[model samples]
Target chain A: MDQFTLNLIVVGITFALYIGIAIWARAGTTAEFYAAGQGVHPVLNGMATGADWMSAASFISMAGIIALAPAGGYEQSAYLMGWTGGYVLLALLLAPYLRKFGKFTVPEFIGDRFYSGGARLLAVICLIVISVTYVIGQMRGVGVTFSRFLEVSTDTGLYIGAAIVFAYAVLGGMKGITYTQVAQYVVLIIAYTIPAIFISLQLTGAFLPQLGLIGTHTASGVEFLTKLDQVVTELGFRAYTSDSPNMLNMFLFTMSLMIGTAGLPHVIIRFFTVPKVSDARTSAGWALVFIALLYTVAPAVGAMARLNLTTTMWPAAEQGNALDGPAITLAEIDSNPELSWIRTWEKTGLLGMSDLNGDGQIQYFAEPPAVTAANKALAAATAALAAAGPDADRAALLAEVAAATAARDAALAEATIGGVSLAERGWVGNEVTRLDNDMMVLANPEIAALPGWVIALVAAGAVAAALSTAAGLLLAISSAISHDLIKGSINPNISEKGELLAARIAMTFAILVATYLGLNPPGFAAQVVALAFGLAAATIFPALMMGIFSKRINKEGAIAGMLVGLIFTGVYIFLYKGWFFIPGTNMLADIPANYLFGISPLSIGSVGAVLNFAAAFLVSGMTREPPHEVQELVESIRVPRGAGSATGH
Target chain B: MADKSSANAYWAANLRTIGISLVVWFLCSFGLGIILRPALRGIHVGGADLGFWFAQNGSIYVFIVLIFVYAWRMNRLDLEHGVEE
Candidate 1:
């Protein structure tokens, strides 16, 4: 079969399976739809959580980002650190309490805790913010992967993706999604690991796979990482495994992802599907095990991809000459159709190359800025400032300026060896990005000349990654709308059937809004994704933890703390990102240069979390304790024994 | 013995597990991973800082151990206190 047909078949089979599972597992009642009738096996729930948690970011892009960046190992470590760490909070603090409260949704718990409808409403709003922002990104990811592999327009891909999601999720409810997600988990992890194993064997000569990462480069006595650092630095970039410019920011950014991972509604809800609290604990461990399989392999994939690209760029003997064959010319892309993602993406203006020095080919290089470039009219001006009238010392300093500018300009001009410039590649040591981090993974397989099956595996992985997360987010959004908004607030007398219908309607509308945002993603969508973690950490995480752990905290205090955390994090991000991150309206570009105390906008969410804890604690001190009755409830939530399956009202 | 403090024993057993698990969680997450990272810099495993491993892999492994340990100990305690199913 033709490659496209083969890809179509693979995707078709997976979709059919999902739909079939949905049909087989259609939820019969409100209980079944909302919490899978609280009968899901802990192990199975862990698998579903794995699929839910491993969004497009984890499955589709993480390894690529790691592979393509030189500082990938240590810098990108937050992807591992924060994501896994958040579970500590979830498994220990939040899961059991929420499960015991036996609410249909997060906002329900918030409402009961605060003794105010407004507090519940406030929580629902945060849920919408975090979930919608998260879902839209997943939708966009699905569109792109489908467009490329399925040979359809992004809109068509989205429409089909939406329909497939609706069939299983809307019809199947949590039970359907649960079993299908187990299937998806299998598909996704297999697709993810197979490619990793192939790449590892090709690179390291080891088959145990994980150990292959640290296995020596058999031909070269030098360690693989040492060789990588040398090669990247030679091309004018930071060494792989070296620190990023903003270490503290990276740390905070990582922490935000961790806390966010725990706070995400889809992930947190999975724990509740199981029958008991002890089961919940074991399930979390399994979920981590499933996640760790990929997490551990990701760095190796990143390292190998970097090596692969560098080696491809310079197929000749090391250090023989800086320029190898020839850098990729515009004509090559113009002539060949397959080499088009670069050219097509360049129009987005994130990627660009112009003939500098009037070179016929795009001589991309890692070059310094105008201030550093010498002769370099700017450099000459600086030389003039440093000049003593015609003195030899002045001449030497001028020469030094020229030499420095030469180096800087060479760095500034994305370096071209032969046909490939270091800047054109992912791992070039030092240059501002002109490409989305997502592109690195997309480009690597093609760069490596992997077989069609391997390429097809990547396609399936991307779709699965996108679909799994989309289903999870859709479920979260729908539950919030139907369970919290309708049953809890708008129509408390709504029948079970009415609530189920409302949930289906909510999901359909959510898919549409998510689709619209995917196409017209806000400027800071990627940055906002990381920010979702922060919001979850700061606002929702604290409230959930306090609700179960501290009986003395009154509804008023928890409400006040959540409101403070939510508004503060939102405003802080908005002030720099814009009013709602409205591209040009940003008060300042929310980068390290413009940040408060160099705490990256990404990491500021951690501060927000801390503030939430403080505000809640301090505010609680001023309020009367929850009724003594509340203290007993808190005690009941902490223990695993004596609690049976909670029937949600 | 007087009453065997059935209620307190059951709650206490649960609390002991939570307390122990929390300590391990703190030590693995904030302790070795972040705060003690500087102190443990000299310790390296397979090219990464020992703290890095603890943060990334080791701590998670420890969490699993702590959890299983908690489950077993809690199960035993629960039966002793006549709380287990």
Candidate 2:
């Protein structure tokens, strides 16, 4: 069978499996719907959490981002460390205590802990906004995967994805999502690792990508990173191992992602499903083990993919003679079987090339500085020629033009590759113009010439990653609406059956909103990720940490802190990313020079978090302490003893 | 239930463990990975320096180990303090 049919069979089977799991594990009560009946095995819950946490961005886009980072990809380690490091915080600082709290939702814990309906309502709003924004990204990722693999329109793909998530999430709730996510984790991890293992064996003669990353390339006999550094620097990029110039920004960005990861409602809620506080602790470890399996391989995949792409463009680079040889010719690109992946991806419009010098060969190199200077001189001479008009010193002007042309040629000659002038070789500019970062992972197997099944598995894996996270986020949003908003406050008299029904209705409504947003995706979908992470890091994380760790933090303090963190982080992001991400509304350009203390909006969350902690402490010190029972409640959650099933009230 | 003084001691031990673990976490990720990276330029790990390895790979391994260690130690603490579920 062809690639499409293979993708269809693979993706269809996975979809059937998820729907089957949903049917098998259909939730029966408010408890089951919200926290998977509080009976999930630690390992299985960890696996499910792995699937829930590693969204399409992790599976499909993370390695790509690392591979294509303009500054040699080393600085992108922020993402690698930041994302996983948060699990450390989760396992240690948050998970065990939250599990012991025996709550159905985060807002429930916040409301009761703070002893205020207002605090719970604020948390519900924060949870909804964060999860909703996050789910939209997942839906878009699903659409991209389906459109690329199944040949469906993005809208149709989104509707199909929404339907699948609705069947699983709305039907089975957390129980269904938990089991399906375990299966998803299995599929995605297999899909991710198989390619890396194959590519590792192909490139470095090491089957293990983690070892292969540091191993010597078989053909070049150079260390993998050394070869990568040499090749990329030859093409005018910084060395692959170069450090980021702004250490503070890197620090804050990593911190933001770390805090954000721990704070995300969808991820935190997974802990509530576990049987014991101690189980919650180890479950985090298992989740990290599963997550680390991919995270460790990702850098290797990125480095190897970059080397592969660079070598494909400059075939001689593999032999350590790139400068002495010609770039890949258009004829070879057109007819070489190994290069067919380029053409196939070109059809998706995410990858493209243009031959500006018309030499029929792609001269993929950074423009030499001399050529830039020469171009400037040529432009000046041309303007002078035009200014002379028809009468004044026409021949002199012509001579000036000739001199400028000669000068440009001389400069081009001085700028040589392997002592051969670019002008002599008739090469002008880079040709591989549009390499979308997503291609690094999605097109990876194709680039390595892996089998059709592997490619199909990748497609299925990307869809699974997207769908699993979407389901998890949808569950979080619906539970917040139904459990926190409605039953907790709006209708204190609501029956358990009525709450379950309301949860299902809220889930359906959430799916509709997510699908609509996915279909119409605001132009600022990418920009709003900063908002999701920022608000989560600034507001929810601080509140939860204080609620569990500090008995003195009162409702007044918690409310004040969350509001301060929310508005500060939100407005800061809006100032740089446009007000509420609306186009052309930014007060300042989103650049380092304009940043506060060189902290980019993406990194401002850490600062917001610090400010939140300060505000909470200050306000609490100035105001009355939490009630005696609230302090005792804090004391109780601190221990692992007597933790029972998740309770609504 | 454990007495208030025993509870306080348990909490302090837990805090100490967390503090120690966090120090390791910060040292690996931020110290060797970022600020102290240049200082460790002489120590090589395969192709890159130890700092680069820590940043991209080693810190994650440490984090995984740290969590399991914390869990194991805390489990023991819970049992010793008669707080085990």
Clashes of each: 25, 0
Model 1, A1-649: lDDT tens digits are 6567777777778778877887788776646766762677677777878888888777656665665554445566666667776776676667755765665677877787766788898888889888877776677666656666766665666666666667655765466667888888888888777777777677667764566655655445555556666666655556666655566777677777777777777788777657776666667777887887777777677777776656544443133332444445567657765555455445434345555444345433344343234325545656565665754566666676667756655563554433455335422232223545554554556555566666676777777778778877888888788888887788999987887789889898878777766665543233446767778877888888788767778877888888888898888877776665445676777556778888866677788888888888998999888886667667666555666665676
lDDT of 2 by residue, A350-467 (tens): 6788786888888777667788778678879899988885678988888988999898888877777545677887865457767867667878998888999999999989988887
For each candidate, what TM-score against the reference? 0.84, 0.90
Q: Write the per-residue lDDT of candidate 2 for residues B44-82, one digit (tens) a residue.
A: 888899999998899999999999999999999999888
Q: Chain A TM-score of each model, in the order shown?
A: 0.84, 0.89
Instruction: Give the lDDT of residue A269 in candidate 1.
Output: 77
CA error at residue A587 for candidate 2, angstroms:
3.7
Candidate 1 similarity to native, TM-score: 0.84
**Residue A556, model 2, lDDT:** 90
List lDDT for all candidates, in order: 0.68, 0.83
Candidate 1 chain A, poorest ten consecutive residues by summed lDDT = A424-433
